[model samples]
Target: MWSWVAHRITGFAIFFFLLVHVLDTSLVRVAPETYNAVIGTYKNPIMGIGEAGLVAAIVFHAFNGLRIVLIDFWAKGVKYQKRMFWIVLALFVVTMAGFLPRHLMHVFGGN
Candidate 1:
């Protein structure tokens, strides 16, 4: 029950990010200079931190979704739900930890 609720919440979160992402990208087509400025603004520290959270949300939503699907169709998978949940959690942590720093550095003009 909780997993289902979380799955829906995360799905919506990812979708919201995707919508904003599409709108932001569309600016590139409307004006190159404006797009550059927007990209620069995205480099702001606040946005950089938000990007890290976005990365974590996307990773968790995707992996947990796969786990849900696998368990739904395969009888054998039902028993491994807890195991898969832990694996997904671990992956989420590792992916976010690695991605956040690199993403922050990239957005903040690192080498």
Candidate 2:
């Protein structure tokens, strides 16, 4: 139940993020200065945190999607769906643990 809700939410989050990303990236074709100026807004601390959240959403969405596919396709996967969810969650935590510190350092640590 919760996994379904989370999968939907993360899917929407990634969709919206892709929309914004496309719009912003299209600015590059308009003019280099415009693109640079638009991208500059993402340099702030608030955007840094948002970026981390975006990464988390992406990771979770991907892992959950894989689990769903397995459950649907594999003969025995339905029996272990709950266990797979826990495995996905544990993988998410481990992935975030590795990514967040390095990303934060790059974002917050001085150049």
Q: Name the candidate that leads on lDDT.
A: 2
Q: Estimate each model's TM-score.
A: 0.87, 0.97
Candidate 2 Cα outliers beyond 4 Å, as residue runs: none
Local accuracy by lDDT, each model: 0.85, 0.96
Q: After superposition, how far is residue 53 of candidate 1 from its true place, in Å?
A: 0.5
lDDT of 1 by residue, 1-111 (tens): 666787888889989889988988899898999889887877888988887877777788889998999899989889999898999889888888788777877877755
Q: Which ten residues in a row have the lowest lDDT in candidate 2?
A: 40-49
lDDT of 1 at 61: 86
What residue pairs are clashing in model 2?
A: none
lDDT of 2 at 75: 97
- Residues 1-111, model 2: lDDT tens digits: 999999999999899999999999999999999999999988788999999999999999999999999999999899999999999999999999999999999889998
Instruction: Please identify model 1 stretches exceeding 4 Å from their true place.
Output: 108-111
lDDT of 1 at 88: 87
